[model samples]
Target: MKLKIIAPIAAACLAAVPGAVAQADNTNFISRPLSLLDCLNIALRHNASILEAQRDLKASQGIVIQTRAVALPQLSVNGQYKDTERTAIESFGPPASSGGPAFSISPPVQNWNGDVQLVQAIYSGGRLAAAWQAAGVTRKQAAAQYDTAVAGALLDTRLAYYDVLLANQQITVQEASVTLLQKELEDQQNRYQAGTVPHFNVLRAEVALANEQPALIQARNNFRIAKNNLANLLGYNLPRDIWEDVPLNLSGSLDDRPCPVNLPDAIRQALAHRTELTALRETERLRQLNVVNARSGYKPDVSVFAGYGWKNSQFVDPGDLAYTLHGWNAGAQVSWDIFDGWLTRGKVVQAQALYKKSQISLADEARQIELQVRTAYSQFVEAGEVLDSQKKVQEEAEEALREAEARATAGTGTQLDVL
Candidate 1:
C-alpha cells in the first residue's frame, strides 16, 4: 500500500509540472517575421487613435452634408389657440341700450381664429453659398486629417515593431555569448586541472557568463514590453505572439536620398493637404457668412404673404342662426430696422476678429507642418545610419566569435585567449 501511494503521488506531481501550453488558434497574432508595410496595415486597421480620427472625419463629412442642405427649402408647421372671458369695444354710433335695436346694441364679443402657414428664405446675399463652401472645405479637411492620422499610426507601429526586433536580436546575441562563455569556462576548468591554464581564466569566463545573463535578462524584458506594446498597437487584449526580426535589410551604406524637397513645398503641401488647416479655413469662410448675416440686420426684409380664413358667430334666439364669413388677404410685408442697439455692428466686429484669428492660425499651422516634416525626415535618416552601423558591428562580432571557436579547436590557443 505504501509503495502504491508513493508511486501515485509521484505521478501526480510529475503531471502537475509546468510546461509550455499551446495557444488558441483564434489568435491572429503576428508571430512570423513581419515587414514594415504589414505592421503599418495592422495599425491602420486597429489603432484606436486612427479609429477615432476616422470617426471625426465621418462626423465632419456629415456636417458638410448638413450645411450643404441649407440651400434646400425648409418646411415647418405652426398652430395657436386662445380663449377670453371679457372684452371691450369702441362704438361710432349711439351708446348700447339707448335707442338702438338689440342687434345694434354692443355686447361682449367672442373671437377665435386658427391657420397653418409656411415661410421660406428666398435669398440671402451669398450667405448660403459661403456656408456650403465652408462645409466642403470641412470635408476636405477631414480627409486630410485622416491621412495624417494614418501616417502617424504607421510611424508608431514601425517604431514599436523595430524596438521588439532589436530587443529579440540582442537577446539572441547575449544567449550565444553566454553559451560561448560556458564552453570557455568548461575548457578553462579542464586546463586548470591539467596545469595548462591559471584558475583566473575560469573565474573570468564565469564572470563573463554572469554579465551576459544580466544583458539577456534585460533584453528579454525589453522584448516582452515591446510585444505588449505592439499588441496594444493592434488593439489586442493579450500578447499572443511577437515578430522577432528586423524586416528592413540594413546591409547597405546610409546614403541620403537625392533632391529632397524644400521646406516651402512641404509647407505648401501640408496647407493643401492637412485637414485641420482646411477646417480652419472653412471656419473662416463661415465667419465671413456670419458677418454678412450680422450686417443683414441693417437691411429691410420684404416678404409677400397670402392667407384665407373663415369664422362663424352663433346666437340663442330661435330666429338667430350661426353665419359663416370667409375672407382672403394678400399683401407685401416689410420690416425696416430703422434703429437697434448696435447689436448687428457688434456681431460684425466679432466675426471679423474671429476670421482674422483663423487666418493667423492657418499660417501657424503651415509652419508647424514644415517642422513636423523636417523632424520625421531627420529621424528616418538617423535611424537608417544607426541601423547600418549596428548591423555591421553585429556581423563583425559574430565573425570574431566564429574565428575564436575555430582557433580553440586547433589547440593553438589557451581557453582564455580563445574567449
Candidate 2:
C-alpha cells in the first residue's frame, strides 16, 4: 500500500524517465538509478528556489497587463436617486404666504438619474507610454532572473553529483584494499600454522588489516552522507537499500572531460551569457523609462469622453408626474499640473538618480562576472595539471608493484612487500 503511494510521487518527480523507480527487495527498498540528466530534470520541476523564480516571472507578466491598462480607454456607470417630502419642499418657500391654511410649495416626489460614460486618454504627457514600456522591460528582467535561478540550481546539482561520485569511488578503493588485506592475513596465518613463518608475521598481517578497516568504514560513511546531501538538494527523500542498508543507486562516472576554451574566450562567453548581466541590462532600460515617465509630469494630459444619460425633468407642475429626458453629450478634456511645490521636479531627480545607479550596477556586475570567469579558468588549468601528476603517480605505483612481485618470487623480497 505504501509503495503504491510512493510510486506515483516518484514517477511524477522523474516523469522525464517513466518507471525509473521500482521495488528492489521484499522490504520495499526503492532502487532508482538516476543519471545526471534525470537529476537536472527533477530539479527543474521540483526544486523550491526555481519554483519561486517561476512565480516571479508570472507576477511580472501581470504587472505588464496593469501598466498597459493605463494607456487604454475606460468605461464606467453612475446613478443617483432622490426623494423630496412636503416639509422639505416647504423650507424652500418664504413662510408659505404667512401661514394662510398652512400652505406649502410642492416639489417632485421622486427623481432618478443615470449615465454610461466612456473616457479615452488621447495623451498622458508620455507617462502612460513610458510606463507601459517600462513594464515590458521589467518583465524581461524577471525572465532573466528566472534564467539565473535555473543556472544556479543546475550548477549546484552538478557539484553535488560530482561530490557523490567522488565519495563512491573512494568507497570502491577502500573495499578493494580491505579485500586485499584479508587475503594477506589468510596467507600469513597459513604460513604460521605450517611452522614456516613466525607468529610476528601473523601479528603484522592482523594489524595491517585492522588499520585498513577504519578507512573502509569511514569511506562508506562518507558515501552515505554524500548521497543524503544529494537527496536533500533534489528536494525528495531517497529510499534506502534494505539488503545492504545502502542508499539510492546513482548512475554515472567521474571521467575527466576537460574544457578546451582559453581564458579570454571563457571571459567573453561569461559576459555575454550570464543571466545576471542580462537582467541588469533590462533593469537599466526600465530605469531609463522611469526617468521619461517622471519628466512627463511637467506636461499636461488630454482626454476625450462621450456619455448617454437619462433623468426626470428638472421642473414640473406641482401635481403632475415628471417626464423623462434623455440626451447624448461629448467633450474633450485637458488637465495641467501648473504647480505642486516642485513635486514633479523631485520625482524627476529621484528617477534620474535611480537610472544612474542602475547603470553603475550593470557595469559593476559585468566586471564581477569577468573576474569570476578568469578565476575559474585559472582553477581549471591548475586542476588539469594536478590530474596529470596523479596519472603519472598511478603509473609509477603500478611499475613498483610489478617489481615487488618479481623480487618476492625470486626470494629476494618478503611477501609483505608484494602484498
Window of ten residues with lowest summed lDDT in model 1? 8-17
Q: For each candidate, give its TM-score against the true structure.
A: 0.67, 0.78
lDDT of 2 by residue, 60-161 (tens): 899888888888889999999877875565435456467555644556767788999999988888988887787778888998999988877766665667
| Weakest lDDT window of 10 consecutive positions for candidate 2 | 2-11
Residue 21 Cα positional deviation in candidate 1, in Å, after optimal superposition: 28
| Model 2, residue pairs in steric clash | none
Candidate 1 residue pairs in backbone clash:
141-275
lDDT of 1 by residue, 333-362 (tens): 677667888877887889889878878887
Q: Which candidate tops TM-score?
A: 2
As a whole number from 0 to 100, the lDDT of residue 263 in candidate 1 is: 44
lDDT of each: 0.60, 0.74
